[model samples]
Target: MVRLKWRYRKRLRKKYGRLIWKVKNRKGRKGFFKSTVHRYPRRNYRILVANEYIAAHLAKSLGLPVARVIQAHVRGPRGRIKRGLISMQAKGGQVIPWKKAKKKLLKKPHKYVKQAKKLARLVAFDAWILNPDRSDRNLILHKKKSGKKYKWYGIDHGISLFGNPTKWNLRRAKKKFSCKKAYKFCLHSGDKKKQRIPRGLKRFTRDNRKQLGKMVKKIQAMPKGKLKKAIRRVPKGLLTKAEKKFIQKVLLCRHKHLKKALKRVSKHFA
Candidate 1:
């Protein structure tokens, strides 16, 4: 329900609806504009916005905790209006980046048993979507005041789906995708020297393995029609008919091969 403005060199020009921040380049160039916000509209911004919207819906269908996204109109610097997305901030808790939360949570596995299982499913979800940017910064940890537990949420999926957001086509979609980085944050036992696994793997326990398997099954069981319906929800002009069809085809293919793809990364969580 909030309208954002596009600022450029102290003047507004319509491109796509993403929040614009003015920052000086490393070389100290003045009036240089750069976007620190993810999923904001810009040149060829439609694809980025579409990627976030589609990913959010698809995640919800999988029963994952994701931020709700909606498209809204925003005015550019010159009073030009364009479509953009607004992600509703999560409430009932203060959200913290995974990077900070891992230190305290990882040391006490018994305290966060449920969170461990959710993290496993999140890793699998990222693999399914072919999102390689699932770094610690992208995943957030929300701690509710009522309990000592923390809930995890995934955000900033602009680079997902077709991999490279701006330069995607059916041809690129046909190429094989890897899930190595997607599982990079999964829970696992670390090497002898470290005596500890990666941050994402710290809470993983053998008990969660069955739950992870169930999550995979849930993903594979997702109906193709439902996936298409989710894609169709994206407003027109954000994506063309061919683009939508291409995404649907890619998702179907990935879902079909998800089990095999996940197998390669199973060791991380095991």
Candidate 2:
């Protein structure tokens, strides 16, 4: 039973990002701010700030609709960490309740048809990064007041990639990749009888495999230099050089195996 220590370069005065104004309350607002402001060394999950930046870049590069994320500096309990992710809160979008929505759509299957393509692309993006936290809360259903149309925007990617609270330099975070983990819709669970599929993944039907495939190809096509530049923008003390390289390797490997992995997940819908 060993504890992982997160290293922070508190004395480094060089700031890597711009200052973000503090918002009053994010609960009901469209754009929300995610900060490790008060979290010091002990319980702080600073890696999330970096992961959010990386995830947002990946999502946008593949043409997925996501909240715009920017680098922001936050003053916290221990010291100020320049590497923070501030997601621009979007307005006029209603959050979807997965359980009720699922039950309602299952009863009247036609309701699912409209969103099938959008959901498929989202699923493809999530599947690429091994996102285990695409709960109903992360999706914002933007309804147009005048028109009878809406689009679902995916957000909250801090817990994606290596899973929640991805502590720096954790061995488990760098575990050997397997197709079993790669193709998994929900990271920690299997295709067992009682296991529940991720809420965001439910709309990804077998019929939308082509959409999924298309999205995956876009992800794979992302320039390596762009990926490196995004990763390099992370706060100085958050991750070591080796850890950044490891993260890149993991993503490249995932992109390579995405199609095969996606097929496995798609089988469940069939």
Tens digits of per-residue lDDT, candidate 1, 1-108, equal: 554432223432222233432222234332213222334235346666667878988988988887666554544456655454544445555666567775557665
lDDT of each: 0.57, 0.57
Each model's RMSD to truth, in Å? 9.5, 9.4
Highest TM-score: give the candidate number: 1
Considering only N, C-alpha and C atoms within 3 Å, which residue pairs clash in candidate 2? 30-89, 30-90, 31-89, 37-76
Instruction: List the candidate 2 regions with Cα displacement exceeding 4 Å.
Output: 1-29, 33-44, 70-86, 92-116, 166-168, 175-204
Per-residue C-alpha lDDT of model 2 across residues 1-270, encoded as one tens digit per residue: 322122222222211122223332324433444544333532344566667877887776676778877654444336534445556655654444343455554443335434547566877777777675576656655554553444556777765664555233456454544544555443332212111244545554455567777788788888899789878766678777767877787777777888876776566663
Error of 2 at 52 (Å): 0.8
